[model samples]
Target: MKIIAISNQKGGVAKTTTCLNLAAYISKKKKVLLIDCDKQANLTKNLGMEGAKTSINDLFLKRKFDVVNVRKNLDLIPSSVDFVGIDLLIQGELARESILKKALDRLESNYDFVFIDCPPDMNLVTVNALTASNYVIIPVQATQFSMDGVNIMIDFIGGIRESINPKLNLLGILVTHFDKRLKISKSIEQDFKDNNWEMALFKTRIRRNTAIENSQHKDYRMTIFEYDNQSKGALDYSNLAKEILKLIKNLN
Candidate 1:
């Protein structure tokens, strides 16, 4: 399976939303496993899954991963607040960085893609996600602080590559909540083009749509495509999934 971490150490950048929806969309064509790596359990809540007996916390503590099948072709390893204390618990453990990698190794043949929804912090949990992932998709917003977050994440990913996973690569930078009518959004797009980072800035920009937020608020827990296929958010995410599939094809 191609393990991808949907990461951004910047809150309000749609990280959890992207991770949840992307996995949903990708699962339509491929068997997908979504792992909620954030202590806040936003992704878990987003899916309307509660009372998970075994979560990612168990993987860190006991090296046991019991996945919950939410639907056909889609499974999830939920997260809980207990994950916040894992750093202290695993202190000085041999190969702590690879704990997640080893857990995932057991399910190597079960999924076509594995998506990790990470927290908006550069903590050990995020480190474990990066160490275990083969690629990372950064969700960025059109804000000055978001740019700084992207730079910080780039440096952090580089450090992880240097010491932990040399093969980890950036899948792309996905622009979220993009508003074509807003000059600030346009400016951010222009800056990405001028900077020309080695990784791609995805062509599909997720437009601001109330449908997406409403679905989450209502606990619908479905992708925009499933909630409202005609919505702009659905179109954008569908396009992004196609682009990701193309990239995966090229990489192979």
Candidate 2:
């Protein structure tokens, strides 16, 4: 099984959305598991797990996590607000930052792709995500500051490499919330390609579209695309899945 974390130090950059969609795509035949590691539980909500119980906190605090099937071949480790204070407990209350790694190790092989939706910070919670994950998929917003925060993520990955997981690889920096017509977006896209990336960055960038927000209201996983494959957002993310599959195949 391949464990991947979808993360960005900056919030509102489509991290949770990407994780959900990616897992849905990978579940065509493979058993995929989506973990809502973020305290906000946006993933849980998007997956229609509102007010759900037996979240990751329950698992961490007492190994009582309940896995629920959100799709035919996909399962979710639902999350709740309790995870917000997890950093404090792991640091000042329990023991260390690596407990998440231990918790996830038990379920790693149960999934073909374990997709973690991470919070928008470099806190201990994120550290455990990095330590447990074998691949890191960064979702970079089209904004100017997105590039600035790349260095911090790189540094953190460096520390993880030196201390925790050397086999961990930078899967790619997925440019999210992209606006094709914006002068800055095109310029930044060029800059992203011209400069050195953390690794082989995916050429497919996710453009900002109301369809993604629309998915939130529809209670589905870009399933709108299945109905209307000609839609731009549909075509874009589907192409992304192809690109990502090629990457994973090479890794295997």
RMSD of each: 1.5, 2.2
Candidate 1 lDDT score relative to the true structure: 0.85
- Per-residue lDDT over 70-140 for candidate 1, one digit per residue giving the tens place of the 0 to 100 score: 86799999998778878778877998888999999888798999999988888888899999999999988
lDDT of 2 by residue, 24-51 (tens): 7778778998888889888998877857
Q: Model 2, stretches more than 4 Å misplaced?
A: 93-95, 218-229
Name the top lDDT candidate.
Answer: 1
Query: Candidate 2 has which clashing residue pairs, if any?
Result: none
Residue pairs whose backbone atoms clash in candidate 1: none
Per-candidate clash tally:
0, 0
Which segments of model 1 are wrong by more than 4 Å? 143-145
Q: Which 10 successive residues of model 2 have the least lDDT summed?
A: 219-228
Q: What is the lDDT of residue 89 in candidate 1?
A: 83
